[model samples]
Target: MTATALPRLCVVIPCFNEAANVAPMVARLDATLAGIAWEAIFVDDDSPDGTSVAVRAIAVQDSRIRCLKRIGRRGLASACIEGMLATSAPYLAVIDGDLQHDETLLPRMLEALEGGLAEIVIGSRNIEGGDKQGGLTAARQMISDTGAALANAALPMRVSDPMSGFFALPRDLLEEIAPRLTGTGFKILLDILLSAKRPLRSLEIPYSFRARVAGESKLDAAVLLEFAGLLADKALGGVVPLRFLSFAAVGAIGLLVHLAVLGLLHGLGGVGFNAAQWSATLIAMTVNFLLNNRITYRDRRLRGPALLRGLVLFYLVCGLGAAANIGIANLLLRDGVLAWGLAGAAGAALTVVWNYAVSATLVWRAK
Candidate 1:
């Protein structure tokens, strides 16, 4: 193809158990792209609901509908990656197979690409004309809005809607950042934003997101937890040491519990022994472990024996972290008068770095 020639654009719909919506979804997508040189790829994540079979039938009649079946229980982001890799199209678009994401916005995205307005185009529900179908529940909407706000605040780039799954960008742009994408999660936007080397220009099209017509919605508790972790990863600049902030936050809370235990032991029980410190450490360690599993490293996928191994490695790392904390504490103590105050700050700063480096390299190495 000549450099001036407009390259092919492929639309990818990632579906899991979306068999019932595939036919109508494809029809709607076709209606929107009447004049565009485009093809629709339905990447099925080994759906048991015959989603792949239905798409295959569609493909037989219309060669534009391609289906890819994943080996294991894959997610939306992984499915999108599979579709992009299979096609030679320079531009790739993502929409929901369940018909929740508006396929009618495809033309607007294509128009923006052709106009050289944006490298990536997003369908936003945050704009004035944008809307959501079956309105989001207050709690769900709040969580989404809060997450987006926090992400925009944390990053240098500003996006009106960062959580929306419907968006389009060039295949070459995605290929450049493929190596940095490790964790299997739903937030491909975060993946792209974090891995993007050059400045990213974005366009937002106002559109309403509809409720799924066929399958049960997969937005469960586990997905939300993974979503939070992805947001945190981006917020921390994708550096492992940033996770130490999470560990430090846990440690700070533990210090509170430790002070209370110390008071209870000495003031009420009249005991001067170190038992209080030891007990508080045990309680805090347990709390940190639970939080790390459910929140900090939720997408790491360490389970059973692998999880136990990770825990052991975590403790070893923490031991080294504690030593670093002590070293900083001693340095401050040498300064006298304001020693305790400075020591506390020094210990926190030192441990944060130490913990993040070790945890990212060892405990959550799989991701």
Candidate 2:
């Protein structure tokens, strides 16, 4: 690739704390994309492990290597979106920063697009020639298989590996559907397939999923929850916001926490109704705050001093909601309008709307 020649294919790698893999990833791409004009863009989410620094060190020696360091923002889907938009390359591919995805498939994916075989090509492990045994552990494999099944049920087009992160598509098609993307979750490929206004022609290329040599795997139980949220967001056609759904789900869990604590204190310990209810409400509120930080506003998640400030602000913002909760439950209990369990649930339900509205605007509003 010459400095003056523009790349026909641009590979966007979204990274976080993958400093150890950046150099190896670049070298692999250089070796595989021999005669193709390709450039690599490493979009780092302000990784604490100095991922951006590593990319720059290589970029200084190779013009085809570049970096887009993002601070105060995170999420693989959004990172890939930003990196793809930053380039003028006609075709775009999204691969993991980890060495798991096959870099050699880039040329074939480009050929498929250029030959008009499909609008998008995915690197699939569920296909005949593909293998996931080398990379995913037993539990991780189970999660992937389950997620893909659920995703296929909701997707417009059937994909063997809807959860696969490795895929390539024309830049224009991406731009056409970019507005419809949720830009909030780990499964961007699923988001793309579901968001399209019309059915997209897609092909799957078989490849072995490689195990990680360095850095921790990001997959966890929380990721599955986020994946469900993405599907729910698409199903609703974006009429209801995704964050509100996540916030409401957390509120539902908080309600259970409230009841459990109330049952323990008032039912078993013989504590006064008023005192028990107040304690339960406070405890549930704290649980809701923590869960919301980790999931609902994850892209804008708080950390360090910011996390402390956010927690305090969350309590303050929900104070009115909590007050309403206590007042309503007391009224129902005093008037004997309902049983204690029913009364408590009624009050908690009222606060969901207030807390979601206020907390979103004040506590986790975009920084």
Candidate 3:
């Protein structure tokens, strides 16, 4: 194939359970970019709804459409990073997998980047002629606006819509900032803008955010937490992932659940101390697994038989981790290595790391 015919743009759609939107998005892109040499990549986090399957089916016939199924990991922003890194195209764009962002604006974004008019092109809902009436409800818009305000205050350069997920930039610029990206949440455009060493020339293109015809929206309370965590990560130099912070918070709650269950069984019901202890341990483990599945690993949640299997595996891993915790604590105390407080803290810290690693790699591993 001639150089002119080679694909010059890669569109990354970070997706999760967006099977219904795959074909429609591909069709819309094909119709919208008639002369542009572009390829659409659906970066799926091993969606249980067979989203990757749908994209692969289309990819079999259409070379311009591709699927990048990521296993054993999840996160929309991370998926976008992986998708962008997999492409050799000179220009890259990120759009919502639900087809909420107008596909027609993609050509304009490409034109701005390819024509040397801008280094970054954002599809803004706050810009003039931008359609804010369609996709986002009042409450959602408020949340977005609040996030944008917080992001702008910390950003090196001012941007009207830093919360926007839809944006385009040169592959070279992306490569330069890729190492600095937090890849933690949904606001990748903000991460890039903040990661840049110097100011970026940005252009906002007005486009109506279309309502989804199929599939549920991914926005939720967790998104808010993730966004907060991203800000923290950027501020703290990426010392910790927001998901890990969420996991630790859930663990703290599980400790309360353990105490409550133990108190209820042993104190109120007059159950044997041994019986109550075992019951509370098991119950707390169960509670932690459920919460982690829902909050920490929401995108890669196991379903059907996988869910049951994961629960059993989680119990085993956590149970073993608990045993290790006690053993290490006892060893430290008996050896007079440190005070009881430090020993116990070290033991708990080790257990938390062990549980998180095992749970992610073994229990809730992607199919």
Candidate 4:
């Protein structure tokens, strides 16, 4: 009896200073993926230790194993990119050298992809029957959870676990997104989501996050900062644009800026009311402009003469916006502070829409 043909699978492991864990992790993966038409490519990021040497030794015995030694110290993201480019398989998988990501989930992940249940199958700790290792401290878990939440808040699609580095994706999709993949390390999931032309189905497989059998974990403060920056970038990409209530929050800040300027000019500066009004309004306008530019209209581009034109139009729109805000605020203020706040918020939201259109068409002009 002849054995049935298996699907072609390429497991790309990104290794950085993981000599101790790399060999064992490679062996485990080889054993795990034995049934499939699998090739394990270990892309080493110039580890000081002899990780490449060990992988090379193993590759001599096993035709399925190959090692890529980048003499220049490349990062995890780049290593993955290099491995993906080198492999010749329709289905590709990414895993960490740390061994925190389970190799046991590889078959099931491939199964999910083969069944057409998901274009990308993630081995998720958040899923049922999945567990994190001892290294995952309370603070670390919270930080990870918060990051995932923020990412979901910005993206249109919600994956139960977006932070998982261990995932399988089709080579075609990877090639499509390869051009736009940001330097934001480790969060390739976001890169895929933002760049993929087709909708992605996801599978949350159960697996335990294991301890590194040999080397230390590489996560650091700098990596966390990079992650936070990625989250901020995602937010600025019109993901959830602070929502309707966020406009009100900006208005409230604007009010504080306005009142503070007004009081300084009138009470202490002793400037006349009309002159003070213009001064205070101008200061408030600057504050609002900065806030909206940073938060509400962040994704919109601004350049050239169009930026100046947009600024002029934004202020003009603000005057109409202010009148509407005041009218609604007054009517709602008669009822309550919350109502007045809501009404002012509504007005500010309308103005943001006005700002978005003019900015998109004229200033930044991002299609």
Model 3 agreement with the true structure over 90-187: per-residue lDDT tens digits: 99999999989988998989999999999999999888999887988888988888898998888878788888889999999999999999877688
Q: Could you arrange the candidates by TM-score from highest to lowest?
A: 2, 3, 1, 4
Name the runs in model 1 displaced over 4 angstroms.
Answer: 1-7, 14-37, 40-86, 115-119, 133-135, 147-160, 172-187, 190-203, 213-244, 260-273, 301-354, 357-362
lDDT of each: 0.76, 0.91, 0.88, 0.72
Error of 4 at 294 (Å): 25
The per-residue C-alpha lDDT of model 3 at residue 233 equals: 76
- Against the true structure, candidate 4 reaches a TM-score of 0.61
In model 1, how many backbone clashes occur?
0
Taking all chains together, each candidate's TM-score versus the true structure is 0.68, 0.91, 0.82, 0.61
C-alpha positional error of residue 269 in candidate 3 after TM-score superposition, expressed in Å:
5.5
**Top candidate when judged by lDDT against the true structure:** 2
Model 2 segments more than 4 A misplaced: 1-3, 303-308, 324-350
Deviation (Å) of 266 in candidate 3: 4.5
The deviation in Å at residue 244 for candidate 1 is 4.2
Count clashes in each candidate, considering only residues at least 3 apart in sequence or on different chains: 0, 0, 0, 2
The residue pairs in collision within model 1 are none
TM-score of 1: 0.68
What shift in Å separates residue 30 of candidate 3 from its native position after superposition? 4.7
lDDT string for model 1 (1-367, tens) is 5454343789888888999999998899788888887888898977899899999988999877889887555566777777877888888898878887878888889888878899889988888789853546667777778778876765557788887889998888888887776435776776677567555898888888776557887664555656655666665667753345456666677668767777787668877657766666666665666677655565454689987887788778877887888877887788673468788787867786777767878887743
